[model samples]
Target: MDTSLLFWNNIISTCGVPRIITSDRDPKFTSELWTNLYDMLGTKIPFSMAYHPQKDGLSERMIQTMGISLGDHLNKNLLSIHPTAKDVHDMWKKACEKDAKCIAEAKEYNKQRWDKSHKEPDSKEGDQVLVSILNFNNLKGPKKMRDSFLGHFTIIKLIGKNEVEVRLTKDFSRKHPVFPVILIKPYFQTEEYRFPSSKKNPTAPEIVEVEDSPGPVKRIIKASKIRLNGKDQRQYLVRFKNQTADKDKLLAEDAIPDANLHLRRFRASRRTE
Candidate 1:
C-alpha cells in the first residue's frame, strides 16, 4: 500500500491531521515506513498488544457487525443462481447501509456499557501502577495458573483522558511505553507488604495426566508444584501415575483442568477396584 498517498487521501484530505492514532501491532502499521509517516505527521501511534484486537474495542465491534452483515447478505442472496449487475449492486448497497446503521447503534451501546464499568482513573506523574497482562500473556494453560496483571511501573505522563506513558521498573526492552488506562490500576505502597513467598501447601497433591481419548488410561497425578519464573508467571511441576522413573513434566497451570476433580475421581476409581 502507498502509505503516504493513503494517509493523504483517506485521513488528511478528509478529516485533516489527527493528534494520535491507536492500532493493533500488525506488521503493516508497525513497519518503518508507516512509523516514519506518522512521525512526520506528528501523530502518536500507540499500538495495542499483538493478537489482542479486543484492545481496540470500537474498531473490533465495527468489524464484528460488518461480518454479521456479510453473513446476512450472503444468506439472503447466495441462493439465487443468477442476478443482474444492477440487482447485485442494489442488494450490496442495502446490506452496506444496514451494517453501517448497526455499527452506529452498537457504538453507542458500547459507550454506555463501558461507562458503567469504567471511570476516568486518576494518576499523577511518577505514580506506581499495575497494568493488566491480559494482552501480553497469551500462554495456553489453566485459568488458575495465569497472572492477571503485570507492573508496578512508574507513570511518566498522563496522556489525554485514558492513556498513560509508563516506564518499566525491571525491563527496559519494551519498544513503546504507552498503555491504556483500563489495563492500569493504582499500586499502593504499604509497609506491611512482604517480599517473601507465600507458604506452600504442606501436602501437595499428586497430579496425573489423563490421556486425551475416550478410552481410559490409568494416569494418576502423583504430585503438583508451582514456582515463579523470570516473568513472574507461575509454572507447574506435574507428576503422573505410573510416570517413567524420576521423570516429571514441567507445565503451565493452565495445562491441567480441574486438578482436584481429576484426583478425586482417580481415588474413587481405585477404591472401587
Candidate 2:
C-alpha cells in the first residue's frame, strides 16, 4: 500500500491529478487507504475484472510499443545524441509508427500460427470440457509426464466474448472458476472397445504394494546438497534394483534407510577418486 501510494503521488506530482484511475483488483489498489485517498480527491477508481486484460488492451499495447521503441533507441546508442524539441517529437513519431507496424505484423503472424491448430470454441453453458493444466501447480507427478488437460468440468456460464465460468471440482477450489476459452477443450468419452468383433475378456492386473515394499537401491549415481526450506539438505540420485536408468529417482538421505550401505560405498568410492 505504501509503495502504491508513493508511486501514485510521484505520478500526480508530475502529471497533475488524474480525473479517473483505472487499475486491476490488486490488493494495493483495493486497499482501504488507497480508496479513501482517491475518494477524498474525487477521482473515480475503476477496476478491471480479474484475469482479463482486454479492458485495458489499448493502454497495454501503447506501453509495449513505447518500451520497444525505447529499447531500440538504447541499443542503437541514439539517446547519446542531443536533439531539439521538434527533432525529438519527429523521432518519437517515427518510432511509434514503426513499432505499431511491427506489432501488427507480429499479431497477424501469431493469429495465422494459432489458427493452423486451433478453431473458434463452440462450447456453451452446461457443456463438459477439459481445462488446460498449464496454469495449475498442485498436480502430482513429474510435470512432463502429467496430462496436459484435466477435467470434465461443466461450463456454468459465459462471462463475455471468450471467457466462461466453470463448475470445477473441489480439487480446484483455490483456483478461479473463470477461464478463457483458449484454456478449455470439449471432452470426448472413450469407447469401451474400438474393435467390437474381438470377443476377449480382459483380466485385471494385480495391484502391487510398491510403496510398502520399495525396491532396493542398486547404486547411488550421484549426490548433491540443496537448500530446502532455508536449510541445507543432501539428496541422492538413486537407481533401484531391476529398474532401468530411466526409472532413477532423487531421494533424500533419510528417505531410504536401507540405502545406508550403498551411500557409504558411494562416499568411499568418491574419496578414492
Candidate 3:
C-alpha cells in the first residue's frame, strides 16, 4: 500500500482518528502527503520548535524510561509476561500517579532549599540593582578582588517570573540586557555609596534630544539620506557606530562637516537622491 494511504488507514483503524496531534518537525511529519492527509481529516498538528528537545520532553522522557525498563527486563530474563490491554493501562496509570507524588515532593524540597535565604526581592522597575557576574574566575591581582556583583543598573522591565531587563550603570558593558532574579540584588544608595554622575540618567528633554548628540569622536557610522528639502538641499541621517548609540541624527548635508569631520567627505560622496 502507498505510505499516505497506509498512514491514514492505521490512524483511522486504531485510535479512531485523533483531533489534535503533537509531533516534532521530522521530515515525515512535515511531508506534503502527511500534511494533506491531516488537512482533509481536519486534524491540527502542533510541531515542536527546531533543535529544542525540551518541547517534546515528555516523549523523550518516556522513551528513556522504556529503554531502562527493557534493559532491566532483559537482564532479569523475565518471561511468560502476558497481560490484557486493560491490565496494562491500569498498571501504567498507577505508576504515573506514584511518579506524580514523588515529583511533587521533590519540587517542594527544592523550593524550600531555594527560599531559605533567597527572599523575594522588593525591587521595582527603575530600581538600581547589582547584578552578579556569572563566570568571574579570572581574579588574581590584589586590586582585582573587587565586588563580585557589578552594576547599580536600572531595572528596565520585569520579565516572566524571576527575570529583569537591566541597563548597566557607571561605565557601559556589552553584557546581556536580561538577567535572572537570583543573580540580582537591590542597590541602596547611601552617603558612603552615592550614585555616580557618569551613570546618572539625563533629563527627559536631554533624553528626547539624544539623536542630536554626537557620540565619541572616534566612532562614526554610514550616512543615509533622510529627505530633500530643495532642488540641491538634502538632509542626511548619521548613525553612531558605538553600541551605546541608541539614537541617530538627521542633519542637513551642509552641517555634516561641522558635526563630525570624518563623515563630512563620506556624506558628500554618498548622497542619495
Candidate 4:
C-alpha cells in the first residue's frame, strides 16, 4: 500500500512541486532516499504535515475487490483476512485489472467530470477538517508527529486561493492564530464556530470576526502551515580556519609526529658525531 501510494503521488505530482502533496507521511515517504528525491525537485516535503485523508468508500471498494480476487485461493476461517497480508503487489495489480469492464466504465465517468469544476475544495469559517502533519523531529524541524488526527480547530478567515487565516479556538487569538490555509482539510464540521464577544461584529472595522463576504470567488488557504518531514537540504563543504594552498598537506602533516621524528634523528646524528 505504501509503495503503491508513493508511486502514485510521486508520479502524479511532478510539476516542480509548487503544489506539493503527501498521501499522509505514509511511512514510505520517510524513507531516507525520499528526502534526496524531493530535494532534487526543489520543494521541501512538509515537516509538520498530516497524513493524506482516507476515504471510506475508496478503501471499502478496494478491499472488496481484493477479497473477491483472493476468495478462491483462501484456506482459512472466515474471520481471518489474508493471513499473510504480505502480498506480492503484482498480484494485487493483476487482481485489480481483472475487472477491466468496470474499470473502463469508471474511467469514462471520471473523464467527463475532469476540468468541470468537480467539487470546490472547501470553504467557510469554523469547519473541522483533516490537516496533514509530517514527522518533523527526525528532520531537525517540527516535533515528532505520529500518524493521527492532531486537533479540531476553526477557520477564522480566508485569504486568496491556497491560503487562509485560522484560530485554534472557539475564542479567536489576537495575533498569532493567523496561519496559512494549506494545512486545513474541510470536513462537515459546523459546530466549532464561535461568535466573538463583540456584538456589533459587522460594524467593527478591525475585521476580527470573519464574515461570509461575497467577492471574486477565491481559493482558501489555511492559516497554519502544513507539517512535512523533508527539507530541500544541501550539505555544507568543509572550510579551513586559515586559507591554505593544500588541505591535504595539513591532513598529511597531522598523521605523523614530524617534529618529534626529525628531533630524534638529529640527536642520533649528534651522539654518533
Best lDDT among the predictions, by candidate number: 2
Question: Candidate 1: where are CA atoms >4 Å away?
Answer: 1-114, 137-144, 191-273
Best by TM-score: 3
**lDDT score, candidate 2, position 212:** 52
lDDT of 2: 0.81
Evaluate model 4: give its TM-score.
Answer: 0.21
- In the range 1-273, model 2's lDDT, one tens digit per residue, is 565477567876789776655566788778886777676677767676545656775665666689998887654445555435338788899999999999999999999999999787788888989999978978999889998899999999998779999998998888998998988888866543434676568899988875552477888989989999999999999988898888888889888657779888999989999
Candidate 3 lDDT by residue in tens digits, 16-61: 7765556778897788877787777777676775356666767756
Q: In model 3, what is the error at residue 171, expressed in angstroms?
A: 3.1
Instruction: Name the lDDT value of residue 17 in candidate 3.
Output: 75
Reference-based lDDT, each prediction: 0.69, 0.81, 0.68, 0.49
Off by over 4 Å in 2: 1-116, 191-273
Evaluate residue 240 in candidate 2 and report its C-alpha lDDT on the 0 to 100 scale. 82
Per-prediction backbone clash count: 11, 0, 0, 31
Q: Which parts of model 3 are misplaced by more than 4 Å? A: 1-103, 135-144, 191-273
RMSD after CA superposition, every candidate: 24.0, 20.5, 23.7, 34.3
Worst 10 residues of 3 by lDDT: 75-84
TM-score of each: 0.29, 0.32, 0.33, 0.21
